[model samples]
Target chain A: MVVSVAHLGPPGTYAEAAALAYVNWLNQRGQQGLLCPCPSIAQTLRAAAQGQADVAVVPVENSVEGSVTTTLDTLWQLDKLQIQQAHVLPISHALLSRAETLEEIKTVYSHPQALAQCQGWLERFLPSVQLVPMNATTEALKYLGEDKTAAAIASSRAAQLYHLPILVCPINDYPDNYTRFWVLSLQPSGGGSHTSLAFSVPANVPGALVKPLEVFASRGINLSRIESRPTKRSLGDYLFFTDLEADAREASVQSALKELTAYTETLKIFGSYSIVSIGKL
Target chain B: MVVSVAHLGPPGTYAEAAALAYVNWLNQRGQQGLLCPCPSIAQTLRAAAQGQADVAVVPVENSVEGSVTTTLDTLWQLDKLQIQQAHVLPISHALLSRAETLEEIKTVYSHPQALAQCQGWLERFLPSVQLVPMNATTEALKYLGEDKTAAAIASSRAAQLYHLPILVCPINDYPDNYTRFWVLSLQPSGGGSHTSLAFSVPANVPGALVKPLEVFASRGINLSRIESRPTKRSLGDYLFFTDLEADAREASVQSALKELTAYTETLKIFGSYSIVSIGKL
Candidate 1:
């Protein structure tokens, strides 16, 4: 059976790279995988939730920029998608353009996150150049084809894929930039080391989050990450997303979540997922 | 003394509007306040921190998009700035262009947040239009002069300021969108009900956050918000930002903070601040 995987693209995007890596991982396990590209992360995830694809690969967090709120927010809204796997991709950005020198570049185009990651370099080199944010890194490649003064910050792979010359490489401000992607499927996967969940506490209560944290704490389960996103109802209301260093199927984790319901207004477990590092893939 | 307030701008940006509202608020209090427009939020906050401006006004949280990570991350990095006041401004986006109809718009430009907020409208009306993200919403104003096919999603005030035609009004998908701006000063302000703070705990500890949170819970201090940002060190490490529904000067808040220090590796109290509503200002 062919497994359809959806990701943000028009090709040469980091999400596409992640989807490719995941497909390789699946193929190694004796499963056929197909790729489907969507314009936005929301549409990519929706493809999985709506059953247009068997799985969706979306970025969850970046080392330098933190959580991808759109991913978390969209995941919260889509009820059926369960995380099947997490993949870590090391990010390296290159300036792709027809311009011979940085001084000749009039504008730089990239994904907002990539632009931000390369902010220090841009400020130092092309202080006055206009920075345009696009839907994806690859989206800027089409514009760079005819404009000699236009540059795009994207993966070196993108420069090769788009046949653009790399004027400069490793433009990201931080040397250790990485983004984590999640492979989400409609059905929950097998045993894994990490469990992701989100919950909202009853409003207007003191330490509404404490009881929920204590649920994991009392059981000696360590939380790998926690993020709070506004509920969109108002400023103060929030939905907390957390990652626990334990499997959802574990007796202790199940017991903790069962007890956690008493303290939360709403709760969702995004399934237990194991991490896969795409080293030099 | 003329109180110089720094904000992201190029006349008619929302930050400029917020700065104007703040200047008016100060004028009513019998103090002279001046506006200094910076090109970016980081520069605006830095101006306050470096004493280039007396205070800086920056968007902290938006009802639809949640916390602005740039504001929070920059605040966390700059320790000298303290919360002075928070102002909530209702956001209404208008499509500004020379084009007479939506079909004439071949491209759309706006700040990333504005573009995201008006995503639904743009998708419905100009599905094929290229959406270009600028640093500030008003930055797109200058580009609309010759490009009849380019429409910008910005404030109606921006259209008026730029002498551009309002092609459409209320372009944002959500009518109730509001952005909360923080007035940051070099010194702590007085008599505020809300206190903001950020802290990082020692890595690899189980329940590292629970004890610090218990301090507030035990003191009956309700938290208004909590957001976690990556430490930029690695994937799992994070720095947590929280808002407490109590004055930092209060005894309970002081005691809780004192105990919080024991559980945290580092903690910063970003002063206490009151809220002001900019009701159609």
Candidate 2:
């Protein structure tokens, strides 16, 4: 059977690139995969949860921007989705435009996160230009061909795909910029090096949140990341998402999980997945 | 001296309303205050840091959106600023337009966060409308007067200020939506009920993060909020921002803070301040 993969796209988004890499990984493992691009991240994940696609690739975190809240919040809401694998994609943005020089650009457009990632560079170079936020990076590329003063911040692959000139390459403020994407499926993939989960502690307790973390800390299981998002009920009410450096299938992890339930009001194990680091676009 | 206060604005943005509320709070205490609106949150904080403004009121977090990252990141970068107070403004977004009905709107404009806060309502009502994100909500108001198909999401105060008709009010997805703003000054305020601080841990060490949290936990000091932001050096490298339920001036908080330094590579106390919740905009 051909495996169907869904991702945020107009064919050239970072999510699409990550999905392509995931499909390539699947192909090497004897699974044929097809790409399905959706207009937004939420829709892409929902496609997987509803079985429109076999798997969904959604960004969870960015080095420059921190947590992808929509991805985390949607993942928390969708109980059926489970992690099958993970990918670390190095992000390199280029200024795609019809204009020959940066000084000629009057407006720059890209996904809001892309604009934020390149904020320092924009401040120094295109300080006065209006920055427009599009739903996707590739969504802005179509305007570049017609407007002389229009530019877009997107991957170098996007420049090739859209036939736009690269006025400046690697325009991200940091050299170490990277985004982590999760390959989520309806069923759990049991074996992997890392485990990801989210939980909410009983509200207004003095040491409520720390008790859950202590469960892993006592077992020498390192926490790779921990972030809090407002529960949406009110300010100060939060649900936490965390990643741990241990496999959920391990006996020690199981013990920790059992103990964690005692401290948490709501707990979810998003399944365990191995990491795959992509070298290029 | 006429106290100058800087905030993100063009008079009718949420930040301006926050600043105005803060100024009113100052007047109640018998101190004169002035409003200095800046184009961005970063500049608003910088105005206080550079002595251009006596104080700066900037949004730190929102109920639905979580942390105002630009505010946190900017505060972390500027060493001179200290939190003098905090204000929680209940957010209520209104659709302001020349159009008579929602069906007549083809393009909707607002700050990106405002758009996100009302995502559920927009998806159900204006599913196919072009969503344009402006730097400030008020920035979108100017176009609403000329384009019959244009609508901007802003506070009802903005509709009154701009003389535009409100097509809908309280369009945010959640009725409990609110934003928390910080009043920052050069000198540290010696008294308040809560304290905010940020710290980075030594990278790749097992259980390094838990050690710092244990300091507060062992002291019975409650953490109201805990969030991690990328250090911007790499994907996994992080700096934590947390708010404690105890004041920095308190003995218990001071002791916990001293112990916290041993586990952290760098730490910054953003001062302690009491929270003031506003009844209406």
Candidate 3:
């Protein structure tokens, strides 16, 4: 089967790198595929849900940045799309510049996420420099080619794509910066045994969270994540997003989900997909 | 006693709004005052630890977004700074423009966080327009004065500061959008009766999380937030950031912290402060 992957932005984003990695993985296994790029996570999920793409790859969380709200919110909102597999990509930032020397660099450019990730490094290395922020790291790279004094904090791959030289590599404050991405698709393939769901509990109820969680604990289903986002309609009301080891189709998981619905004001099963192993970089 | 409050930007940002709310609260109670505006969360905490600020206000989590990793990481890294009090400030976004009509809006500008928060509203309201992302919403508002077709997504206060007219108000997708901010001080006087800490567990150990969490459960300490950020050193290693009731000086909490240290690879207390009321706008 051909799998079409969707990612954020044009061609040189970290999302694109992840999508390419997934494509290469499929190709190495002798699987045929097409990787379709989308401008945003929402568009990518929409494409996958509408069968325009068989599977979509989007960033769900960042090790140094916590959860990507857009991805999580989209997963909660999109009823047809389900997470099939997850991948964690190690991220090493690079300072790219069109100019050859540090003396010539004046303005530094990058996506805010990239800029924030390398905050300490930038303060230490380029304290007096003018930091110019942009929409995407690729855009910064693109603009660097036009403005000689400008540098960009982007993936090393982005530097190469824009024909810019890396002034410094591994520029992030934390050496272990990584981004977690998830594969979303319409089909619930039970072969990949993982599921994600979103739900809300009644406000002011004591042990409201514990009761739903106990359902998973009793069933021996390992919960990978449990996060709460404010429901945004009232004070103290929260929507909980959770990841579990068993697929929603499994008897135990289904029973747990059913029991959870009784305790929760609202429950949504996002998707169930077999876990995908991240092959070597 | 004097309190030092820290926020995100120079003078304008949501963090500033929340900090001001905190300051107003202190003023109403006739407390001594100091406001420290740090460029980032790390700087804010550093100022607190270094005794530059009596207390600092930093964004920890948001209703739409889950957690701010910078705040979480700074808490993890800093040995002295602690969370004294937590407050939730309601966020209302506005579309500020120099031009009067939607037809004149050729570009929209905002901070990445603000832009992401208003994504659904922007897609629905201005689908055909170009998005001109900026470093801060205040910067966007500043630029709007120079460009006729540009509108900025920022707070009403920003519009007032920049002397721009509000074309639209409360444009966020979530009507109940709020941001959770923690006040950090070197000495724990104003924070009253709560403590926050960061802890890490051994890699590849199943149920390693349950033990420390059980301390809270067993003691009925009431956990407010629990977040996992990858260690980045190892593939599966993670650091958990949690907030619980009771000050560090409290017998039960101190005992739990002592018990928790034996069970985890690392345990650090961020701060203890009095809990603040979740403000209504």
What is the C-alpha DockQ of each candidate?
0.72, 0.78, 0.36
- Per-residue lDDT tens digits of candidate 1, residues B1-281? 89999999888999999999999998998999988999889999999999999999999989888889899889988888989889999999999999988888898888989988888888798999988888889888878987899999999898888899998899888777899999998886765989999999976677899988999999999988888988887778789998899998899998899988899998998989899998853
Clashes of each: 0, 0, 18
Question: Model 1, B38: alpha-carbon shift in Å?
Answer: 0.8
lDDT of every model, 2 decimals:
0.90, 0.91, 0.76
Best by TM-score: 2
**Is model 1 an incorrect, acceptable, medium or high docking prediction?**
medium
Tens digits of per-residue lDDT, candidate 2, A1-281, equal: 89999999988899999999999998999999999999788899999999999999999999999989999999988888999999999999999998978888999999889999999999999999988888889998887877889999999999998888888999999988899999999986766999999998876678878788889989989999999999999899999998999999899999999999999989998999899999953
**Model 1 C-alpha lDDT versus the unseen true structure:** 0.90
Better of 2 and 3 by TM-score: 2
Q: Give me the displacement of residue B263 in model 3, in angstroms.
A: 3.6
Residue pairs in collision within model 1? none
Candidates 2 and 3, the one with greater DockQ: 2
Q: State in Å the error of residue B88, model 3.
A: 3.3
Which of 1 and 2 is the better model by TM-score?
A: 2
